[model samples]
Target chain A: MAEQAFVTGKIETPVGTVPQVATGVSWRDRWGAFRVRLGFGRMRYTVEPGLYGVGAPRQDSPVLVTANYKLSFDHLRTALAGHDAWILVLDTSGINVWCAAGKGTFGTAPLSVQVAASRLAQLVGHRRLVVPQLGAPGIAAHAVKRQCGFSVVFGPVQARHLPEFLGRGMQATPAMRRKTFSLSERAVLVPVELVIACKWALPLAVVLSGISGLFGPAAFWENVREHGGWTMAGLGSGIVAGTVLTPLLLPVLPGRAFSLKGAVAGLMAGLAFLAVLLSRPGGAGNDFAVWAWLLLIPAIASFFGMEFTGASTYTSLSGVRKEMRIAVPLQVAATLCGMLLLFCARRLP
Target chain B: MRRRQLYLRGVATLRLEQDGCMGCGMCLAVCPQEVFVMAHGKARISEQDACMECGACMMNCPAGVIWVQSGVGCAQAVFHAMLGRGSEACCAIEEKPGGGSCC
Candidate 1:
């Protein structure tokens, strides 16, 4: 019943009656995807794992396999607008195709089990199942064939190309097979990154502002208004630099390490913040505080930038470890030194 | 413009034993980075640096001749690992009472 919004009808197969899904993505699906991108109910967004039909699939229709994540299912069904296809979804615990494949949930065992559970052999006359290319990391084609009696054909990386791929007899071109992190792809990831960063940064900003009032010759509230405002600005700048600027300028930014690129973006943001601080009347209060902002902003930004490696498509575990070995120590040292400077600035007359 | 997006150089842990290769070309087809290529009827490591160590080739290779220490290149996961949370630290929802997992 939860999936009734997308399920338009039911198709009767030799095995049983399968839910027939609509090929067009409704406004509800779009809203759901947008909410997930904004970090709402992301982990629970899943569909029922089983066999589904699109456009009245027959026994000879090509079988397309995917993860149980609702987003993945929506994309696949939406792509096959006019085509009749059987969608065999594996239980990946709501994870997308690529990440689930890496975790082995989309691998041979689950595929084999789903094949048997769905009685796919009896429903489909063809012996081929089109799995997403990204799922290759977890699935052994030979092993799947040996266990389930279905030959696995790795499909194109994106669902948009499904129509063309199916049209060409399931043959994917080199471009279709390759994965590229485009501007839009990088942009879409930014919202979740910003939301995550803000959850911690906003609270930290308030604490830093409250601590800023503990010193200075001015009244506690006035100092809080001036110095505390500066601290909040610095934290905000770091968040924007790390989560927004770093991802948008990922390719063109200097340095191969994500931390280094983040530091560069942080430096730019820090300089801008400093310029604004200096330009304001009576804004330049404690010189040590200025130095603190310079160091702290970049350190914070660099750490957030490094966090993006997990979301990136090309970073390796070894490379991330190597970068962390050097960058983590430097970031820690900078943060400590910056905090120490802030203490000195506040304690001084 | 084709901006070159390169990660750390010469640090990928991917290794392939040429003798055990079956020339199935599965590695070539599955590799998103195109790290493998068919050379003289055998799969070869064409671009070692480009590999993200996702282990697609190793998993799909029927011969089981490839080896790579595969894991996510995420700093949050590394931090969790440092806290002894193990390598499976990925996007798990409600990992704690009210704590959400990092993506």
Candidate 2:
């Protein structure tokens, strides 16, 4: 409800009553955004594109432009806090401004169209539109100016520094322009990534657990308890290491490619798993079982890390492609080999 | 996250055509990697190593001297590319690693 309020507004623009912006966002909107980010109930998210008022703004307020992706919209308004401004949201089909800009949805056409659609010229006295720095790629400043008779000013990379940016005559300091991927930023993304990965990982885990049961000489339930649990545990650990821990420990983990970093974490996880088994009276199963994990766990972890290269700030498209070209085949082969060894371990006396 | 010292090199696909540079300083402003800097009033490639190939600089450059083989860095796109299946990944659902089709 509060989320909609931000998007749905009625304000007196020079163009006359237009859909204005909300004065504030509530805790409900923040929670909703968090839930959606976690891959929960995503369908309900989104707000209409148009001009919005942040606080109570007269015609002289600065008009900031952003995408209609609820998160981007929410973050922009949240950053404004006590300031009075006009937010002009372009319909990016629920994508964040940075991503949408790259996609061309947040490009010069949309900016120009939204300016016209929102009747922005009539609403604001100034001819300047402050756009997020990340959106610069999609916009041709000269083209926008030529088309709309308004100039584009690229603002700071992050929304939090908008106040300082606006206060300093719109001059962004060097630090404000830089984009950093912090732990919190990476951590917040884990839930959705993990959930997405699990769509495949869980089914594979069950299938492997069943395969592991075939090797055990014990009763069916006994096999399920031992081999199934162990197999599931192995897959679970790999998923956690690859998806969760890798991103958190990304900086500390060794390697330039995310795959290498993930493999390193997977190795650590596998070692810990081995340590637990070795602590038991008989140590961990036979060589097949032990070697099997060594081959599989890191493979899974490496695969996760490699997949994550897409999400990280550091990796390049060509770099990711290179990593996948080399690493993906190796990972698949290792996992297959590990599965074969597990088959051997199960069949052997 | 702290900036990594080295991402995968021998693969960045970034090229700067110095002849076309007019020192407009647009590239410097748009690059997140600090990949370019103005020297003698013309833009020069300072640290091509860290370039994530976001292409923001290239897109914003009025002189059009910058070139980067930009694409998404995520696995899903790679997954699609490798298999030649499943069009582009959903922008609404996926966090685009800039330079990919998701952008």
| lDDT (Cα atoms) of all candidates against the true structure | 0.87, 0.78
Q: What ranges in model 2 sit over 4 Å off?
A: A1-3, A7-9, A23-25, A42-44, B1-5, B85-103
Write candidate 2's Cα lDDT for A189-228 as tens digits. 7887687678778888877777666667777667778778
- Cα lDDT, model 2, residue A269: 93
Clashing pairs in 1: none
Q: What is the DockQ of each candidate?
A: 0.64, 0.44
What fraction of the correct interface contacts does each predicted structure contain? 0.65, 0.55
Docking class for model 2 is acceptable
TM-scores of the candidates are: 0.96, 0.92
Which candidate's TM-score is highest?
A: 1
- lDDT tens digits by residue: candidate 1, A7-65: 88999888989999998978999999998888777877889899999997897999999
Which runs in model 1 stand beyond 4 Å of their true positions? B1-4, B92-102
Tens digits of per-residue lDDT, candidate 2, B1-103, equal 4454568767788888988898878787777777888888788887777887777887787787888877556666778766765433335443432212222
CAPRI category for model 1: medium
